[model samples]
Target: MMNHMKGPKGYETEGPRLIFEKKLTKTNIRPDQSRLLMPFKSLIRNDFLRPGIGAILVDQRNVKVGLMLTRWDMKKNSGGGTLNYALTCGSNDIVKGNRLKKDDDISFWSFRCHNVICFALVLPP
Candidate 1:
């Protein structure tokens, strides 16, 4: 059986750290597995203004696994907005079932409403 250990107060023992530590390479990550992906320049630039563009979350294979919906809006902290950076993960049932239980590094790219491409390398807690 998998031995699970508890970390700090707000941390998971075995989470998405593999994705963060692993370099960004072209790997064959299944949608049903936990993975992360990077976005193309064009796709990144268009995400901000066009809500339809949606938020794309990738796996190690550079394949999009999930889309950020209301969560994106929640990040808008103007009025009742969480005002936090919008980061999301996408994947199938298996991947979702085994989400990041601990803090992990995530690379994100998105366009602002002003058509400015924004990039962020973050460790989600």
Candidate 2:
């Protein structure tokens, strides 16, 4: 049998695409870190995001949280580099408010609403 997670409310008609999913680690849930590092090359669409852009994401409880899209470059020995993305600003509060802990699973979804970039977080049951 195939199991499918329910789509977010109000998005049944045209649900947002799944951007990425992560299992919270020590650094992710820790208050000191205060940032959620997305996987390298995880961003498939650039039209919706830019470096230093502030994004508002709605959590599972429908609470809108503000976060920043930051780009980090890693220098390589071969004169090349890699780009990485992370969510900052309100990461700590999301961890605290949602009582998220290490090993918790979370899925992030993205969609454009009226020319505005929006995201949604789906927490494990």
Candidate 3:
């Protein structure tokens, strides 16, 4: 996790730690798929997430997008204890609203506002 990093869209340079950043892939923007996969290697910390709980994230425009933090356990099927995570639920709306295309760079930042966990999706200039 990166702390005290500059935020996108001229946000404060004091808070909003960066969790991960990646270029959009076809799977992320496909309407049929809808979910944005967070590869294991890219995840900084997931301790802030609660199981089965959905979260609302804001974009640079302050548009709210609901997303569910989900984990896929490989142990149940493949007998491997590895786990994978993804952001689901309203991810498609985020993609549509942001006009995200393949290879478009985006970043996820985490912060706490009024004791509530908040996230922001940032687009590269």
Across 1-125, the per-residue lDDT of candidate 1 in tens digits comes to 11111223444333222212322332313454333433222132333333323443433333433454322333334655432222234434313343433333344433222222222233344
Deviating ranges (above 4 Å) for candidate 1: 1-52, 69-81, 84-99, 110-125
TM-scores, one per candidate? 0.29, 0.74, 0.74
CA lDDT of each prediction against the hidden true structure: 0.32, 0.73, 0.73
In terms of TM-score, which candidate is stronger, 1 or 3? 3
lDDT winner between 1 and 2, please give it. Answer: 2
The deviation in Å at residue 46 for candidate 3 is 3.3
By the lDDT metric, which is better: model 1 or model 3? Answer: 3
lDDT of 2 by residue, 1-125 (tens): 00112334453323367778878889888778888877567654455567787777777667778899898786799999887788899998888887888899887887654445667778867
Model 3: per-residue Cα lDDT over 4-118, one tens digit each: 2333444544346778789898988999987887776677766665656676678766787777878766465656666667788888888888788999999888776444555
Q: Which pairs clash inside model 2?
A: none
The Cα RMSD in angstroms, rounded to one decimal, for candidate 1 relative to the true structure is 15.9
The candidate 3 region of ten consecutive residues with least summed lDDT is 1-10
Q: Residue 57 lDDT in model 3?
A: 76
